[model samples]
Target: MTSETQERRPLFKPVRGVTLAGLIGALAFACGVALTATSGWLIVRASERPVVLTLLTAIVAVRAFGIGRPVFRYVERLVSHNAALADLTDRRTAAYRQLVPLTPARLGTKRRADLLSGVVRDLDDEVDIQVRVVVPLITTVGAALVAVVTTFVVHPPAGFVVLGSVVAAALVGWIDLALERRGQAASLAARGQVDRVAHLVASGANELGAIRATDEPMTWLAYAQKNVEKAAFAQSRGRAVGVALALAVTGVATLAMAWVLDGEVEAGTINGPFAALLLLTPLALGDVVGLIPDALGSLARSSAARDRLEALLTQEPAVRDSGSEAAPNETVPHLRVRDLTASWTGEKTDLGPVTLDVAPGEHIAVTGPNGCGKSTLLAVLARHLDPTGGTYAWGERDVRDLPLDAVRDGIAFVDDDPHLFAGSLRANLLLARPDADDTDVLRALERAGLGPWLAELGEGLDTHLGEYLVSAGRSGAESVATATERSISGGERARLGIARALLSERPVILLDEPVAHLDGPTADAVVRDLLTASAGRTVVMVSHHPIAFDALDRVIDLPAVTS
Candidate 1:
């Protein structure tokens, strides 16, 4: 097991479908196979007319036994597949929601793509073990036990042989497990490399053009290719070990069957049906034993993935929720911070021992030099990051005492680099309020100066965008068009983000350089419109331009905040 796997939270309950299917499958298999074995005994004792009737009865029972085999297989597949997908969905949603409270600024030194990959892909892969490995393992072992016990009751020597072969096969399987575990660790490392390489390739695509002018693209490709090789090498080694173990077990079973037949013949106790039973017994045991190593390999990976995902799900956010609610009046203070201090890591303080207050209808501009913790201050006030020390209150209640939903509903924030999901202009705008009507969406879009841009596009509000465009690539020209259609100019993207914030219409709005890419005149117009739009709300903004601060009710200079 991986070190991270130990961190996984235990599943609250076994998956219902997998558990139920496993139970039914194990019982059905035991009964069906045991009855078939009994038929073998009857065929050996009976002859002529009795033998023919007995054979026919056994064939009918066997046919019934196999009747729902496909159905059973389908049930197993459906149960296992859904469990992984459901768990992945839960983890992805939780991770993104956790990110809402932490904020991008609070991520400190972590890479965005690496974290994204872990939360999205990594967690999903991990939870699959619950259905795939755990349930199947339980059923297989249970079925094996039933088979062994039945054999023992019929013939003690056959039972002894089966038990001994099982023990020997298990020992070989354990050895395979040891080899597979090492391979699994290597596999995980290889996957991490792949993730990192993909991230670099994405972020450095433009830079890669310049680098390729100096023939450096090959170097980057080589590094990525090497990671792929490492992954393949590890996987091959694991599968090879499993295959070797299976072959060895099958060889041992074959030898045991040969010995059994020789001994029965010498004792003159061999009957046609009895001989057939001996031959079938060893082969059936071998088939079951062979499945062990393959299942073990999958289990190891799934176990590792499950543990990592669980750890993330169980983690408490660094920020605490506040039970405060927004009251409409401008007289009551909407937010107040007293000597609040915070740090991404506890060892080094990033902001304050500073005090601030903003009442409803107040507009505050926070100005500072780069890296002076201006954004961090706004994040804390917005309750995206909790104060490590001191108290922050909204209205009369402490911020931490406020309900998380209440705090979020009362506040809307627009970052300089706003994330736009893959969708049409109307679809993206409506994300702020899914049920918003066309009028509501167009109003927000026009306010952010996006209506003209949307209208200019032939597809208008229905234009498809984002990573999904890759699917529409039918030719080189189509691929180029797809990329261009989805691509947003920096200024346009900024306005799109602001449009979303405007649609929210929260009591408190926190904007981090909303006019980041606009020229002098356009920047002034945006600030003026923003101030006008936020007439009866609390606004906190980080800005450097003096003109941007004109309508602010308060200006908090970061130089005044001390560690």
Candidate 2:
């Protein structure tokens, strides 16, 4: 939750040298093509066989240069490709960091799966535009133009034809812009639908199976299938248009080039050899021109992706800190919330201008019915969300002005649903403190009551506990069920959550229903451990458990907020 080091561009560094290399490679390629063409013309027109060797030597030199240019091309690609990949990596990191601060406000607005798709798939696809479509197109087309001009010095008609074809291709692209936009829109819609269904299927696979057991699996599956079909239809339509336009242009160019060559040859202005070379130029140039519309459509899709990324980059983190404020370790913060109000801005307000204060070393309980906003209160207190009204101050300073990292480092939160990452238990525990060694890991595991789970795995601390079992002896479902049924029940997960929070050594801890999933004995033990763990720190917890009421220093209840 800490703010990453503030740096100039997070992921995308512009490498000017790559652009230079691409240009050089493209130029060399075009030169090689023109040289080979000129050498053929020389062999055909030479008055003596003695001159044929010179033309043959020119052909060999051109082929050698052509072979070597791919190496330069590879280097150019490597630079741009790595730069793009690195930029995407940084953009993703920044987006995640931004979400950490905005998550409280997002509560029900943003879907994690959708945002994840945008970060991983969409961002990657968009980078393909810059690295693949844009850079390559520019370099090749620019080089083609140079080659055409050089050819014009030899034959004005051929040069004119090349220039005219390029212009026609540009015009074709401009005229088809509207259709391209429509295609892009379709592609975007298809992606969004896919993301929605993917999230639904992933989160509900087990539940859907349960429904299937009731002889109603077809109902949901039928609906999901219909959605998939619709998305596929849209995507297919988009791509079909791109392919259709590309083929249409190629057809038109082929016919037009043949007609042009026929007239030039019949008029005796250019011989069969010259006409042969002229025809070959279009065969190559036709492909180059045909790619224009597809590239534009690609550009459209990539632009949308860029906008998504830029939206994240350009966003102001809900809590912004320049690191000039006091660090977490340097300050003992006594948080006070006076008439603090928060609402889910779009919907009717949920929780309100409730008042509360917690001095250093104080433990407070927030108890309320399901919709009463106990969780919302804790979120606002942790600086996850800004209050609609009133003020939150830490040791007489406005909490908003405090550095975001400072707020995050000072407070540790354990939500109702704890996340277990796909890694070893040791790795999951160390997420809060990556540098934690074996002793610290063992102590944390012991506190969380995960010792038994570790012992069962036999690999102890090194065994993987991801959703999928790493070894044949252990299956994912079996491991989860085993851990839940015996070693770490909901109560145990709660205890583990508390243990993780405790390991953070944060000054303020916010836990939502920490003992809700626990059995009576475990719950009681955890409540005692919670108090002991937060002995000298501020602890604010939300729980409807009556047992929590008797053990706390103070309790506050928030009534549902109204407009």
Candidate 3:
């Protein structure tokens, strides 16, 4: 890796707020240990019929430690969680900015939904390391040190026992780290595969069942699940060993401390009450030391997550903006592709050596069989993918020389699957043109043939959509409103997508099989409305259906490539 690349890699620096939280947590653990030891000493001393005044100080101290432990823990949780959440928000924004240039191309062959889900999961895991792994590790180490030093001050031999037990626990933690590291990669891969399969099966259930291919995806899901289980089982062995070793070491240390105290008390080297406190110290300290092994496992998982995120974000963009080019100026942009060929991966050409020219306000359709690169051609034209060979020009200037945002702002792309967020009808429409008023949205809707539907709505633009309408129980006016929102058909969805594109006011519009999922009649009507609505713009659509071929000014038919 180049020095610049190395410098660009994300590093998790310790947050001051989190460090403070960890310190508080360490103090809390220490307080708990002191409370246990002090309480034991108080009880044993009281058994000898000591005066009430003599027990007063130890009683007050025990009560204070007991109360401080929970209070400090609560404060630690609040500070650490807030710091982690704030860090998560900043990292998510930066990571998304890095991912924008890599969309639909460098994000790999996995389903886009799966890839995006992985990014969210990995980012969450990475951020959680601060709270789950880092803070706990710091707190454990700090508390253990305090326990060792305090016990050593009371009884030198007992202090050494506590130190030896801690060293043994550290060795166990090291072993846990090695075991987790061995399975981390495999575990991550299995998780990704399971996520991919689960997303595919859920999102495409209807389509797969329609084609009777449900069994195939289910088989793949089962295989992925088995691998995930296997990895989990293998990783669990390390945790099990750590837990067993912790218990055994604590038992041995407690016994050793008790035996040494017995001899000290018998020889009059220490008071009977003080011996009780010294004997219970190791048991209290064991609680803090036991956390280290579990924290190590969290460290391993977070490390894996960070590595995956870095691997994805470090890739070079498929299309780089020259950064020194001027915007192209054309009232109605004209496009020319001469012998253009492109690839998702540079190793194989998926699109054309074929050529075409699009004049201003021209309506053209590119039709081809599946895998014949119609969508690939549209992707290249939309500047989402870069051409490996040939020249693509906009208004007589090479597109590669134009600023990326300039080119993108002049063109609008509507894909086969357009997302509808859960919001009011007005809110959904305004996403296309945020500054547009209700009148502008209605005009766009009418232009795309939703005039009749809009007129029939009782709430007009205020009608609620998405999950609320689907799940809510309704009566009277609510029932009517629910019916109105739920009445949107496949044809209306296509028109809504076109309406959004129209609101962009871009001179060139690219549609990639927008009506592919509709029935024949609905698809034909949608295509007709789209062509009518976008009459003044240059519309280049890719489709295999012959619904609106007669309406298009020209049609380009792509032939299949044979090796």
Candidate 4:
């Protein structure tokens, strides 16, 4: 578990603001029930030819209740939404912080895009409960109780009927919740599988076609889609049954109330106008319950989302964030290791059971055949994963005793696939160093062999990239077209990644097959520029390509087994 979640807040923690919103919601629902009852009485009494002045009060009451319903409802919505959004902001921040430490290694096989999407979507569902579930459920129950007591006062038997109907509806709601809970879990699981398969097939279409391997992923995608459809249909069927039962209970209760009222009138114990008012009250309350199938489903969905979040947030991170203090501040600190061993999973070692040392400003390459742990060694050096056995140090300071981010901040680790966003050149480069100016950006680009590319651009730093939304002004937005569609190639993208690393201005650079995707000539050029741009910095390049070893750097090759 992360430090952010150590003092975790409950999904619906007790708060005065939420309580106030609930009370407002209840009041609004009561106003709706009262309006229907009064209007019924007014109409019935008018038909009976009462004294005109006596009718004046009933006419005025109907007007007040009618206006109050909408007005109170608006206030209720305002209060509930305000409180919910405030809590949502806080919860989103906390949940994201908890997720950061467990990323990559602990996140399984999912891409960062998939992980981020799930987190954002789940958090939204969890927060929506305050407005969608709690407000409506509380409002319906509170207003129904008020109707029950008022009916019992006017006609005792009718009151008992109202209470029984309400109890039955509440039971239906409970059953619906239980069924929906199961249905929602299944639907989410199925939908997640479908998305995963669809993404895999869509993203790897070219590779699959090239290798004639499309059949299996395509078949799996179809199966996952069918499962989603089945899950969705089952969930909808359960909801339909629940709604039908709740409405049936209301219909039965309305008839029982009528039967009792008819007998009361035959005995001359109650009047027609009074009976109309009492009958209308239950129908109005029943309408509230009738409107709640959507709310019930939302409650179930939110519960499922909360469970997913809890599962993720409570997971222990793969690496320990140790020490009360960060690493002592240093640029180009000497790196040393003694019999290091590490693993992606806890059960087996994937890298090391080896040793290495590097002086400040030394350039070194870790090269090996496939399965020799070249990438795994870089993971340990970048502080992404910790050594499971033996020791590593930075300038005599044991790295295990240093905070992860503090040690990581001193190194610029660039991987094979460097993500570029859809924005202007300036906006994209600004990500590496937010405070960097246009000159710093240009210099970085020039250093990474992008000077000629920049000069070729008509707009230079203002050149827009792939599709994205750009703010037009304070009031609106516009879409930017794809700039990379015109002249950008794979080599340019690789060089851009190198430029970003140079812009980071860290004392050490770690490259993990940065040119793995480029062609022979392009890869050689990129490696040359990289070695030139990182002349002074301590550089470690992990590659099996001989072109990567062109410069003055000792190559350390790892055998299949290190002892």
Candidate 5:
């Protein structure tokens, strides 16, 4: 989509509940103004020694207005909150769906946790604008109009004073919004830095301490916090100016109304009791206008957030599905790539114009230096990324011509950092093959060299794996912080990942440095067991350690990029 189209899109589409809430809010504020003005009129008339029966109407009206204000406000709060929450749910779901296709390629180089945090925070800021800015602004304007018109019908000069005061308050709100917009971008950038630093510190504390790099990350955290404080102080100054302007205008308008009423009373244009009502009208209305500055600040923040969300959602996916929907052969499929080149960004090539071929049921190992394109090749083969040049074929048919889902269904790709979800071992393994029973799961685990580890587990397949550890003796384990301490060893984790792939039962399996963190002996043993378990399936393994495989059919070595 074009930038112009995104700019024209509305952030908050009006909901029915918000509309109802807005009407209720306006009525509530109007009641507050009426309560204050009627009470003033009633008190002035009472002091003049009027009969109690003659004052009954004003007395009853004052009581009704006083009681109605809180009631309407309570209903307004419930309606607006429900509407905002419903809007938040829909928006979050849409944003997540848009992000799925982008995945690792377009999300940038930031840590996954930091990217997710920013998305969540931005979504909250966008949704909050409805309650904070839109509904309240509607209510304030509606109440102000009622105040101006009512006072005008009673006394023209008092009406003009109230109108001028409201205009001045609006001017202050606009100026505050402008000032907030200037600082909001900087504040958002600082907030992103803080999130990145905080996520790194929280998730990698052990690694940093082990490498004696803890002080460096701490220094970065301090720097980000300083920027956040500075930005907040600047934004706060704008809000303060808005509050002072509102107060000053309100005071001026109140005194001006009193002066006009004094002249009108002497000229017999308005009675003494009626003059009291005009004098207090502006004071009551000023309270509603006082909320304008903060509402505008929220408007500025949410506007920024909306723009960010639009930009992210409009990004084109790295790989597009082909027009053709042909399916590959269901049986074990052969794989071939001739002069294949891939790029994370289309502007430059990151992976080579390299070539390889594998017959069905063959085992091949790919090894290269750090900057080589082993993992990039695997991404292209798995259809998670697009190839910039040449061709990749499955079962002698160009993979691009096949249905995207059909091509991906034939292969299982496991990387070094496989995520273990917060669930039981059975749940984790079942994700690979949902139809697989406990017997199938145990067989896959045993084949992947996890039989010994499974035997040691007190609950076997029922052992809870992540966040909260559960065993036979421990029935109340809820400490997520220590879950990692109870996790399996490096080799066991690698084998579990392999077991997941084995259980997939796909025609082709691609392994990307799955044992990179294990010791030399463990790495060799894991690779040996992985090959044994993946027998008769077409397998491709990428490793930096390059363990010798007795049953390996072929080896492909990638050359490093020179320039």
Candidate 6:
């Protein structure tokens, strides 16, 4: 997902195999209709005492149609499915490209499950439309055209009946689209209601319990469920109405074809055997038209999904991508900031308008009250964001002149919550530097004050650490309960973050309240260890504990913004 190479593609663009799939699907349906008509004609002709030899061609035609129908249908499915899946891969990659600029700063909580889920589900639904609606609709239209044309050549009046049936079916499809569009609003409202209640209950459970309103959420939940039911029922009704109206149109067309064939046969204008063929062709065409209503319903759903996706992906990145590929020359560059200001929302001042500077290997601490932009400053320093105002120079060149990726290569950030992926201890460190080996990992662990902790586990680099690990007291805590999947107390966890940062060996390290959740003693210990381990490395740490300020080279206290 963090990959910078972007081959962004249009979300709703047609995939390559769609046309070929449509043609194959059309031929498959056409074969079925032809088989039905030819069989009907053959049965009628046989009833007139025709010789077996006379029926040979009709028999062979029926056999060919039967086999061809499934064959073409199979081929169509193969092509359409492969194309759709391939497109999904490309679209997912593009979606990630769009999301790269929004990470950390723009998408709060670091990993936004809701936003990610919405993107995945909506993109999938959009891609599904190509298979479920577009290809099938094309097949239906093509098959109907073939049926109508052949029937018309046999008898113009019969041809008109088939065409009329198709038009009526199309009208039913229009009705389906209207109903679907109307229901979408209700469905969205219901979903929103459900989400609101669910979030309120999940995040405010303790508050609700204190207020003795635990049952209130149940009431809201029921109400939300009711709305969901209503929306679902409305959608079902649209499908029912479409199918019923389609069948009614089919019946009318069948009767009209029968009447026209009767007139032609009576006037000696059509043979009795051939009249059966024309009559049944229109009736067989009902299958083709019958599905249009549902296809349109699918189209409506895809359109809604596409609109949402467009709204999300179309947002301008909060940061300007310099797109510079130039590599940084200095191992530890001098940092200089002049009247620098940045905003997360791009609408309000989130950080700075203050001047700051630090020579290589000089450590600094930024202390400020909440909303004074401590974390925002870290984000800007990490090049995750663009400053709305001011200039920050690294190595005497404006940081903006450096490629984001190139500049980021020299920076490491360890925040309050450092995510530990579900993997081995070695794998977690490798995320910072994939090329780092066992010796490098061990060296980094030693530097971050995790060497004693690692030795205690006995698993060495193979020791597994998953989503969350409660860190025991300090390094080499006696008999800290160890598990194959998760082990390590809060202090150990904090040091692991430091180890990763050290592993990357970035020139500058930014700590965003790294011990915000740890107890005072543990937090102070972790902070002291980080500063000691960070010798000769430029470090900017955001902290509230004054104990931490004593060891820093300088402290910048940010004032609260006035309303």
lDDT of the candidates, in the order given: 0.68, 0.66, 0.84, 0.81, 0.84, 0.82
Q: Which runs of model 6 end up more than 4 angstroms from their true locations?
A: 1-13, 47-49, 105-111, 206-213, 217-222, 262-273, 323-327, 420-425, 445-496, 519-525, 544-554
Off by over 4 Å in 3: 1-12, 110-113, 181-186, 195-224, 235-237, 455-458, 467-489, 561-563
Q: Which candidate model has the greater TM-score, 1 or 5?
A: 5
Candidate 1 error regions (>4 Å): 1-13, 27-54, 75-117, 120-123, 197-221, 322-338, 355-364, 390-398, 457-462, 465-486, 515-532, 543-557, 560-563
TM-score attained by model 5 = 0.88
| Every model's TM-score | 0.80, 0.80, 0.91, 0.92, 0.88, 0.85
- Candidate closer to the true structure by TM-score (higher is better), 3 or 4: 4
Candidate 3: residue 475 lDDT (0-100) = 56
Clash number for every model? 10, 3, 0, 0, 0, 6
Tell me the RMSD of model 6 versus the true structure.
5.2
Instruction: For candidate 6, give the lDDT.
Output: 0.82
Instruction: State the lDDT at 220 in candidate 3.
Output: 96
Q: Over 4 Å off in model 5, which ranges?
A: 1-8, 195-221, 266-268, 451-493, 548-551
Name the lDDT value of residue 455 in candidate 3. Answer: 74
- Winner on lDDT between 4 and 6 is 6
lDDT of 1 by residue, 1-563 (tens): 22222233555345546676566556555554544554554556465346365576666765665664455656666766676567667656655765654545445444665567666665555555666566666656766787788768866777777777777777776877777777777777776666666666766777778656525555766776787787778777877877787777767765776687777867888666676565556556565566677767776776676666555544446675443564323332478888788776667777877688887778888887776778778778776777888888878777777676666667788877676667776788788888888888878878877777767665556666553322334455565565433556666777777778788777788988877767877777677777777678788898876646767788888764455
lDDT (tens digit, per residue) of candidate 5 on 192-234: 7998889889889988889998998899999999999998888
- Tens-digit lDDT track of model 2 for 1-563: 33344443422233444456457546545655555555455556553454566667656765665576566567667766776677667656766765665565543444555466556776677766756566656666776787578658867766776676666667666655556566556556655655565666666778878766524444555666676677557655665665565566556655665677798789998786676566566455554565566667676667677666666544444444545666544355788888777765635556676777788988888887788788778877877766677888888777777687677778889976576656766777777777878887777666655566556654466565543334323565576454432233576567667767877777888888877766777777777767865788888888888655677889877676656
By TM-score, the candidates rank as 4, 3, 5, 6, 2, 1
Candidate 4: residue 359 Cα off by (Å): 2.3
Error of 1 at 417 (Å): 2.4
The CA lDDT at 522 in model 1 is 73
Score residue 135 of candidate 3 by CA lDDT.
84
lDDT per residue (tens digit) for residues 1-563 in model 4: 36444775575553346666766777777888888888888899999898899889888877887888888788888888888888788878888788877765777777777688888888889988888887787778778878888888867888899999888888888888888888898899999899888888998899999999988998999899999999999899879988998788878887888887898888888898888888787777877787577788998988888888888778777677776475655677898988888888877778877789988888898988898788888888888788888888888788878887788788888888776677888888888899999999999999999998888675678776543222222222222342234645778877888898899998889999988888888898888888888877988888878765758468998877453
